[model samples]
Target: PPPPPPPPPPPPPPPPICQDVGYKVYRLVPKPSVQDKGGDTLELELPSPRSSILDTLTNMLCATCKPLDTPIECLIEDALYKADGEIYVLGRISEDDLIPFRSHKINLDGWADLHLQDFLNLGFHDKNKKDNLIVVY
Candidate 1:
């Protein structure tokens, strides 16, 4: 008989830190006249819900994936969320301890809950929340 196969290595441990999910929307914006380009210039639009570091990643990825008019179809590089303008990505709104979300891992359920409104709020609010503190008079 073949020597006993080594016990399957314990499943690789899960990541130490749970990464947060990031989302972005791509809009068709014309390039500035001042800038000279052969074809088109992919402009990076600020994501809503107050642009965060994570959101910027998505914007940059979509913008960089030029040649292709739409960047949403491109493979996700690093970490980012892609969506068409004015469309809210769908996901359930529920309270669960182990709910599936994507940042490092793609979770359909979590992605569904994302709404365009989330991106629309960008720049309107400070993500760092430093300004959120109310000063009591």
Candidate 2:
């Protein structure tokens, strides 16, 4: 029999010209547990929400992939929350937690968690705060 025909070429990427390519908006709605207990109108303003963390986390944590552009978030054996110009860390994170996290055994959710504004208050924004207790560069 004769050979099959070749497949079509892949589509080109969208142009770089200005266009309303639409946007993705995220809202920090309370979880089911919180919503069930929410009696009144509770408002919450979340801080620096990234478009995606799974891919970045998977690459950085599992593989040796190191992204330079993303902000640095790590944990150290300390009690204070460090939010310098480069990194973010919650309560102390010693070798115990760091080892597992580095090995992809656990995730960063409970022990290390804070809204965007809170983190920025310690890092860059430095605005809309009272005393600036968080400490930023």
Candidate 3:
């Protein structure tokens, strides 16, 4: 008898297009205060290069004042609220805690070390507090 036709090859796996998309995790540490609680961890998907994560974070933290352009100061201070109704600046993560976000552990050598200040510049013009801020990313 003639040999049966071989079964059709399995459909090609879906293109790995979405695999490139990834997320970044950030810790929002509010300035220390007697009436304030600890910080909050936020996970944000990598936005397009045209958009800024700082803007996204500002929008999430503050709904009232959304600046159209990058301001000269830390917006967190304007957004964060204390039990006493006072505004405070946000703290930056230590260099040790500042690491690049990777979906996998492979080829870590290629990833560069990223410092908190490198991404966000916290300007403390006054000795009493941090006033100006800029998002470098």
Top TM-score model: 2
Residue by residue across 12-58, what tens digits does model 1's lDDT show?
Answer: 87778844357545555444335434478654443233244334434
Q: TM-score of predicted model 3?
A: 0.19
Candidate 3 lDDT by residue in tens digits, 1-137: 99999999999988766342455456554433343233764443332332333444444333223333423334234222222122222333332332321111111111123343443432222234343222222
For all candidates in order, the CA lDDT equals 0.33, 0.35, 0.32
Measured by lDDT, the strongest candidate is 2
- 1 or 2: which has the higher lDDT? 2
If ranked by TM-score, best first, what sequence of candidates would result? 2, 3, 1
The candidate with the higher TM-score, 2 or 3, is 2
Off by over 4 Å in 2: 1-35, 38-60, 67-75, 78-111, 123-137
Query: How many clashes in each candidate?
Result: 10, 4, 2
- Residue pairs in collision within model 1: 48-119, 48-122, 49-121, 49-122, 50-122, 88-116, 90-112, 90-113, 91-112, 91-113
- Per-residue lDDT of 23-121 in model 2, one digit per residue for the tens? 543456433332233676665444333234443243333222233344444344332211223233333344343333221212223223434444333
Measure candidate 1: CA RMSD.
Answer: 16.1
